[model samples]
Structures are given as C-alpha cells and as structure tokens.
Target: MAKRIAASLVHAIETLFVIAAVALAVALLLPRLFGYTPYAVLSGSMEPELPVGSMVYVHETDPTALQPGDVVTFYRSDGAVVTHQVYEVDAEARTIGTQGIANKDADGSLVHDAQATPFSGVIGIAAFCIPYLGYAEAFCTTPSGLLAIIAVLALLAVASLLLGKSGSRRAGRRARGCGNDG
Candidate 1:
C-alpha cells in the first residue's frame, strides 16, 4: 500500500513539473511565434490600465488601419517607445495623437493628447498587457536570476534521471523475482 502511495506521489509531482515547464516555455516563445514584441512599461503615464513595470505585447500594425480610441505604441521624437490611447488619427497627414488615460504632469495640464506622432514613428499596436511581469524580465538579466534558472533546469534533469533509474531498477527486481518460490 505504501509503495502504491509513493508511486502516486511521484507521478503527481512529475506531472506538475512537466505542466509548469511547458507553460513557462510557451509564455516565453509566444511573442516570437506570433510577431509580437514584449515591451516593459517604465512609467505611470498610462497608469491604472497599464501600470508601471507591466509587460505589454505589441504587434506590428498598419498605421493607416489605426483609429481613434485604440491604444498604440509609437516612437517619440527622441526615439523612445511610448504606448497610449489614440485620441485622433489623421490619415492625410499620417499622424496620430495619443493621450494617457490618467496622466497628470506639468507637460499635460493643457487638456490635450500629445503632439501628433508621425505614422512612420508608429512601432506597433498594443495587443495585451501583463501586469508586473516586467520584474521577471529584469530579474532574468541579473546574475542571481540566471543562476536560479540554471539551478532549476539542473534540478529537473537530475530528478528525471533519478526517476528513470529507480523505475528501471524496480522493473529488474520484479523480473528476477518472477520465478516460482520454493
């Protein structure tokens, strides 16, 4: 009975580990698989909806297809990427005016969207945003985080190898004991 319970526990753990590994792999590859770029938000300009340190996935989109009320990511005059809600789209002039839903600063007290960003300056349209995931991205670049990832992969490999060997040893013992006992 104890052996049965132990087997069950091992099976459960292996299943959970596989599921978690697959989920993490998919999340990491999703952007590259679907023409999306994950950009981390560094400011609270688009706060409340897209809080600071969130990760937003942007997809390449035709600027002409953009319309008012749509949120977009565009390049600023200084070449910085900024994501905000589109307030106006001028197809003739190939420009878009965007504003933050909750931005309040010395440069934004005039009650208007930002200067019309040129269509050529548009980077991509915001598809979705995951809050606080930017912290993970930052951590991934750190030495500790990299070491942690390596440790996890090594642990997984060792666990799988141990499980495989134990199972094979049990099978061999069972085969030897299969003969009739006097």
Candidate 2:
C-alpha cells in the first residue's frame, strides 16, 4: 500500500511538471506564432490600465473592421507611434478619431481632433497588454541578455542529452540483470 501511494504521488508530480513546461512554452511562443506584434509603452497617455513600460500585443487589422472604443496603434506624420482608443470611425471617409485614456486635450484641443488618422496610417489593433513586460523584453534584446539566453539554451540542450543517455543506460542495466546469464 505504501509503495502504491508513493508511485501515485510521483506520477502526479511528473504530470504537474509537464503541464508547467507546456504552459511556459505556449506563453513564450504564442504571440509570434499567431502574428501578434508587441510594442512597449513609453508614456502614461494610456494611464492606469496601460501604464508606461507596459507591453501591448497588437494584430494587423483592416480599417473597416474597427469600431468605436477599440484601442489601436498608428503612426503620426513625423513617424512617431501612438496607441489610443478609437473615439469614432467614419467608414466612408476611411478615417478614425482617437484619444488616449489618460489624455484630456493637447494644446487646447481635444486629442486627435485636429487630424483624424487615415486608414493607411493604422498599424494594428491592440490585442492585450502586460504591465512591466516591456522592461524584460528590452533587457532580453541587450547584448549581455542575449548571450545569457544563448548560454542557458545550450546548457538545457546538454542536460537533456545527458539525461537521455543516462536513462537509457539505467534501463539497459535493468534488462541485463533480468537475463538468465550474467
């Protein structure tokens, strides 16, 4: 009974570990796999919900597909990127009015009032946001961080190969022990 209980606990632990590993892999790969582009917030314009340093995932979208209240990212004439919620959409004119959640007015005018963005200026529609993830992303792109990542990947590959070899050897020994002749 004790041996059976121990075996069951071991199996449960292994299952949990597998689940955790798979979840990590999905979290790391899903964005690129699904065509989502990540952008980091540089200002507090979006405020409480999407604070500065937050990372947002945006997906390519058609101009006609957007609706009021949808958050989007687009470029200004000077090529600066801005992310804001859509205030209104004019399908016929193919233009969109936007305002940052935290922004009230810019230079005494309602934000984006002077120039409504044309469809061609739209980059992508905001999909999701993760606060502070932008810092981690920025770090990972640095020279030292990239080297550390490569080193860790190499270590993991070596460990897995060694573990596989050791496991096979252990199984072989057990098989040999069961033979009639040593």
Candidate 3:
C-alpha cells in the first residue's frame, strides 16, 4: 500500500512538472513566431467591440494598407498608447483617425500625420480575445500574485509531508507488531 501511494505521488509530481514546462515554452515562443503582442483591454473605451478585461492578440501590419474600421494600437503624440478602431486612414495625407465605439465622440481630432507610423509600428492586433482572462494574468504579475501562488504551494507541500510522515509511522508500527520467526 505504501509503495502504491509513493508511486502515485511521484507520477503526479512528474506530470505537473511537464505541464509547467510546456506552458512556459509556449508563452515564450508565441510572440516571436506571430509578430503580435498580447494585451488585455483595460477600459470601456472600445466597448461593444472589446470589453474591459478582455485579452486581445494583436498582429503588426503595414501602415499603407490600413483600412477604415480596423482596430489599431498606436502611440499618441504625448507618448501614451491606445487601442481603438480606425475611423479613417488617409494614406496620401499620412494621417489616421480613431474612435471608441462607446465614446461620446471621436477621440478629439484625428491622430496627426507624422505621429502615425506604418502598420509595422503596430506591435499587435486583436487576434484572439477572451473575456476576463486578463484579470488572472494581471493579478499574476504582481507581488501579491506571487505570494498567492507560493501560499498554495506551501499548503500542498505541508499536506504531503504530513501524509508521508503518517504513512511511514503506520508502516513502522505494522512491522513491529508483526511476529515472524526466521
């Protein structure tokens, strides 16, 4: 019985380690291969399209090929970054305009010429989005998130230690109580 339990525990730990390694590899490789960045929508600015706390997978594109109604992520004149749907793209004029579906008006004036870069300048696009998953990702990036994970791991470790200790003690008692003449 002890041997069976030990084997099961070892298998479980090994399976968990393999899963963690695979997840880490995928997270690292995805951005390089796809040329897209993953961003979590943090506000209602683009609501009715991308809700708050949604995960967006973005792809870089060419500036000349940008069409109206395409959602874009860009840097503003003040160095602020925003993601909004393109209202207009004037290639000849080298200007782009964007509006939030939930906004009362277009975000002031059009994004000025020269300020707008090529689609290549866009770090990513909304490729794959999931609602609410961003919250977990965001939480995990913080110190508290790390602490929470550590706490859970510690709890599991303590439980495992106690179980192993009790099992060994029970086995020892059984061996001592058994009377055999050899």
Tens digits of per-residue lDDT, candidate 2, 1-182, equal 44345545555655665675576446546897898878888888888868887888889999889999899999866788888889899998999998877777656543654578999999999999888877666667789977976776675556555655655666687888953322
Off by over 4 Å in 3: 1-32, 78-80, 105-121, 176-182
Q: Flag clash pairs in model 1.
A: none
Give the per-residue Cα lDDT of candidate 3 at 141: 70
Model 3 lDDT vs. the true structure? 0.67
Best by TM-score: 3
Lowest summed lDDT across 10 adjacent residues in model 3 is found at 110-119
By lDDT, the better pick of 1 and 2 is 1
Measured against the true structure, the TM-scores of the candidates, in listed sequence, are: 0.62, 0.58, 0.67
Per-residue lDDT for 17-135 in model 1, tens only? 67865764565568769998888888888888898979898999999999887889988888888999898889999899988877666785624454789999998899998887766
Give lDDT: candidate 1, residue 20. Answer: 62
Lowest summed lDDT window (length 10), candidate 2: 1-10
- Candidate 1 weakest ten by summed lDDT: 105-114
